[model samples]
Target: MFDRATTFGEALEDPAARSILERYMPGIAASPMATQFRGGRLGQLVALVPALEDLAERERFFAALAEVGDGAPRPPYDPAIAPDPAYEPDDVARGSAPATLPGPTPLWEPLELRFAGPSHGNPFVDVELEAVFTRDSGQVRVGGFYDGDGVYVVRALADTEGPWSFQTRSTARSLDGITGTVEVVAARDGAHGPVQVDGFHFRHADGTRHRPLGTTAYAWTHQPEALQQQTLATLADAPFAKLRMCVFPKSYLYNADEPDDFPFVGSLAEGFDLTRFDPAHFRRLEQRVAELGALGIEADIILFHAYDRWGFADLGPAVDERYLRHVVRRLAGFANVWWSMANEYDLLWSKDIDDWERLAAVVGEEDPFGHLNSIHNCRPVYDYAKPWITHVSIQRVDVYRTAENTDQWREQWGKPVVIDECAYEGDIDQGWGNITGEEMVRRFWEGAVRGGYVGHGETYYPPALGLEGEVLWWSKGGVLHGTSPDRIRFLEQLQSEAPEGVWDPLPSDWDMPWGGAEGQVKVGYFGFNRPRFRNLILDDGGWRIEVIDTWGMTVETLPGVQRGQVRVELPGRQFMALRLTRLED
Candidate 1:
């Protein structure tokens, strides 16, 4: 019998134990690290690796070994971890709904039909449910998911205002052959529907310009209830329009606490049931997404990440597909949702490019709305030229050159470049987490002028902000203590005033980063290069000039309208920009 408490040399005699090592720590069978680890207790291998020191990681590693070894307890099923599904059938027939239920459902809002079906056996894996929603424009096929206790739901969105009908088809007898009708009405005011790629930029479904001023708070939802509420309250006033948040609770540096809930059934002390999902966890997520929408923010939801103490990141191909489909089925109807395939996806070493492509295909196939999709990178950037990729989500590959290459990447991919993880403004010990507030503000302006977007994060040590625990703004979504947000807000206001299609980088000197349309507007940002006076090449026309103090949030206009090829006076300060607006005669 294999034993984790015994030395790995003894455990290696059992082929099953060796196989477990090969599965998790690939290449370890022939690696030098194995030789060192093999001399110690098999369970002590985690201690050899400094990165796996956390309670969750330790529990996960030993549990894996125990699962394959002797006397392994059966997989756990905790009732508290599983909650009642969020569906209740009304006075309708068993497999059918009323022909017309309600009137004038808003455009792009979900129309849900719940049916009581077979709860026996694995309904999650056994049942297949789908419905075709037909309207005046066309018919869209939407997939439905199995909620617990025999409840199956078919949720669909109507883009046009008209009477829409839907009929369900399922493998289960009780779920199949259901029919219903909903009256689709005009979209509510400020309801822009989902964001879509518009050439090198983004726009809403109704063609409104959407420049993504995003920020990252990877595990905000997994925090305590009070902290989650605080995060929402902070976000309500912050200038960020999009949030890069993770679907799974993160397990990494400064993030060791057991989450209030998990996506799968079972506790961290016990392993999760891969076949089942925690519906309450998803319901909480939905409520958070809805709340974010109410505050006019887009949820750039990350589906996978490598900072996992749970085994969600290491799920097999079949289970991965099932999980992806399930998430898409539930959240696709939300107009504010954007699917980020993963955060630093390459860090998930178990997966390859092919695996990512298949998962992306599942999202495309399952989501009827066709929400924006992209994968973030840690080191090797994913080839964004793939047809399925809507835009490029990136973490700077090189330190010191964060958002400076925005224009180059935009040209290379012919897509919008979002620098989602340019080093954050913080006082932390890690280099990636401790850039100055001024530097963060500079990157924001630099990226904006180059026809790209940059994301913000904060990692100030908790005590520095006079708080108790590790509640950094980057991962935990606590209050922001950095000075970048106000400057970024100023930058956003300037961007909002500029006309559409204005911020594409124009030909300029290597030192100056500038962008504008030919005859409308031009903004030249002199980042760190504080020139007292500079000659600007402009079209021969009357122009109005304003010197902007990006840091101070002040705009000063010169004496009068200036003509072509003028030498403009500047403050000779860092984080200063010159704006030129063509004076229409």
Candidate 2:
């Protein structure tokens, strides 16, 4: 039986009053509030007499509490407990291959547990924890839960100075209880004499887990000869089955004037004459593809943006449909290649076209080989292209300090989606610009894979010779840019290692929960009542679990509840993933 009014008064008296005040009345703290009492008194409440200030504060605070009423249950809170730091990796021998870590098993296996509770007042916070073990060659391999949703594996050189510790934090919800577990195993590797694995498992009554859905690889837009060789070497190290190459003619066209400035060009103008389109560069690129194929990489080429031409205006009516068809035919000959019809057709609207229909029509007719085609849509117009294109590619931008429009795009276009490009602004002081390498990886996985999208698409960290150097209209100018060979290898490995066709269980309708009408399942948060609830049929073994927050940070998980209908809070943007397994008979 908590007293709301008393609790409110006590809360005001506490040292955390400033935070609470900022939360409830952000402007009031900075600007004085004008109040008119029962006697028609007029004054700025925050600036007047001290006695009135105390009285007004008390009254405003209690009035807020009165809305909740006494006996309102306090939300869950879990405190942060430091993880055990005295762990070491199990040693492996000098000549063995890396093995797949065991999957999450039933509670019977020996588990090393680590747990942390919710922060003070936040209803939700992300829960991320990992365990690391050292190998004989001094590399440290890591396995852990990322943001309490996706499980990841990392191979890195270990620090000899100290024992490793695992850390987990909830990105969204304030959890009541926290727990973790780990089990160690010894194995051998060729490069490292001995390798150890600390098997990890994480659980939260309110959290869900998601497995990697698919893999994607990107081609560097431009590079120095030495750097290109280095880039190819890095690509060789990645485990990607599919690779995307930015095969636009614009790279050659833009660099033609400054041939010496071209990073990987043998002879820029010679390789890129529209009338006599050279096959030499394409041949060289093909050779690279063949090299990648030996290492298990499949290639997809950007068929648009040749010589700065994306759509009608850029290519112009003079080029005619015949030339386009010829280009498609030549590209289709490559056994390892697939066609990405356009770099971003949505931007074509500015090129004087009313719609994308004309462009799609031309490619549809010209592509006789049935090359797989997809369109990259500018961030604001992805949904508009859904009906026109075979697949949709989303370009995510930072609108506020947060990832802009992801939840909205997912809600609107429930199709195969890819994040084609993403980045913070050039100014690092802006909260949005401070994204980390780790956060970038996390966002890509969450937005594209776990969010039920098709694949994680990418825009390269522009080089000194490519679009960044010439396309001043959209360049960010090195604020937070550049990708190393190691970065590409990491992405390649992430793509190759992820699972395929992972299920995403977001109900088709956000406002309405699925009710079991014939063969659907009902889903909604507790205490939210609506007549139209349905259940999803698990007849096909294709079901995977995902949770969408109707509101930010607030989710409903009942005690002892294995399965039930529940609604999620959805004010701020957030989502969760749960790995679904078939029930035993």
Candidate 3:
């Protein structure tokens, strides 16, 4: 609508509306008209008029434009068409008739976007749109032709809701080539402001989902009481079937010989007495185990990284094996306990493995407790002692940095794998590197439950209670100790309610969208651990079957199976599921 300047121009027979326009737009009144309008924060602006209008009115406004600055870059203005007066939602549904409207046809121009701010995380870009109009309706949409990445967020604002739709057109080329379209409906309200919307979606070049392995670590050493309390709270709220507790030998902590320079000491071991085996230590551990049991939590204790100063040298023939026997005998009585032979014996000297094997054999002989036994490998050394070990606890290290290598370890082990310790050095100083709080949660859930590996949760360096310097290793005065209680809750919620049959593989690799084509292979698996379901069923094509044993070994396979695919299904969430195929197959 023209301002009061239109009437004034007509009354005075002034060829232009410059006199009235000058008051509102100051710099444009100059003789040469040096003022210019830019398509900056204010998106492309346009003026519209009914076609039936007289040229006298148009000439007045257009001639007034002559008073504006010359040689200045002025944004191109496109007029928009008015909505069809007869168009109605009900009429369209009935297929009765087509609606018509007045005014010139609307024109759309390519939107130019600029980086307005830094990205929030990896591969996320933030942009700002210029040339926005305050009164007219405008919209913008984005998409990629290739499928590597897609929109992650979108937002819009308006005085009132308006009709609009976003379109994402896919292409076979790189993700960068994708294009987006935004179609805005014609509508207007004098008082209402322009509309804006923001949102995002995930897409892959080949239309396949990018599912990465995730894992977590449970390093609760500094505040035993607080850890136990918080863990109990987490278990009560969410379901966590397995938990790991690191048990350092005496040499690793409270070393009077090197009190000032102990490698990883965090605090003095609570109730640790090297002179004699104390009943209280075991009792405290038992109490903790009982608490875990009350909330359906199971404990996996580390027996390798000794807190004792004697270290591996004391494990030779000179030290009677009876001493080791007594240690396991006293601790094996707990119901919720699983034995982890060593922390990272692969990293330790080969002599450490000898001592571990001897100790493991003795513990197996003496305790005779039907509990499960496994060893946490420092790297991927599951093949070294497979015959003696029940299952291999592969420490899937720094998954954020070395995610690509995970599949290699899983393939070689060919056994049920538990990511015993998964974490990054939080002290690296790059604001937690590429991993984020949300990604951390996703990694653990995807790696263990989705990827079919027994996943453990871990946080970096635990805080030091009063036990600083003498008992614990890697303690930082309570700054980094204890479990992220909220994270546990989130994990439990996600795992406890995962889809049924999620642990089983698809009917066949052929069932996948891109099964055999190059760069088209898709691999995924699902499994869980819970009291409700305990058995694992592995499918060997055409009705063939095999059962996974308690030790996680595929004991037997039906002969003469023709199916190339294997499907494993368990009854409940406590089981792990894995599905793997070549990415480019």
The lDDT leader among the candidates is 1
lDDT of 2 by residue, 192-279 (tens): 1111111111111112122222233322434335545655565555433455555543433123323132212234445422232334
Error of 2 at 107 (Å): 46
Q: Considering TM-score, which of the candidate structures 1 and 2 is the better prediction for this target?
A: 1
69 Cα displacement, candidate 1 (Å)? 19
Highest-TM-score candidate:
1
Give Cα distance to truth, residue 53, candidate 1, Å. Answer: 29
How does candidate 2 score on lDDT?
0.34
lDDT of 1 by residue, 485-583 (tens): 989888888887888833788776778877866568889999888989888766778889999998999999987888868888887888899998998
Q: Mind giving the per-residue lDDT tens digits that candidate 3 earns over 1-585?
A: 222112222312342444544543334334252323321111001111232123354346544544543334433322322223222223232212121111221121112111112122222112111112122344333221100122222222221233333332211111112233233333232111110111011111223221112222223432345544654564455434556664442343222432221112132443222222333444455566557555445566766552343343223332324334434544454444567776655433323345566767776765433345777654435353355565556655554533223334545654344555554323223332223334444345444332333343332422324433332222211232333334534434333332321121123322111111122112222322333322233333233333322123222433444245544444343323222222211
Q: What is the lDDT of candidate 1?
A: 0.80
User: Candidate 1: misplaced stretches above 4 Å?
Assistant: 1-103
Q: In model 3, how large is the Cα lDDT of residue 219?
A: 35
* Backbone clash total, candidate 2: 64
Superposed Cα deviation of residue 562, candidate 1 (Å): 0.2
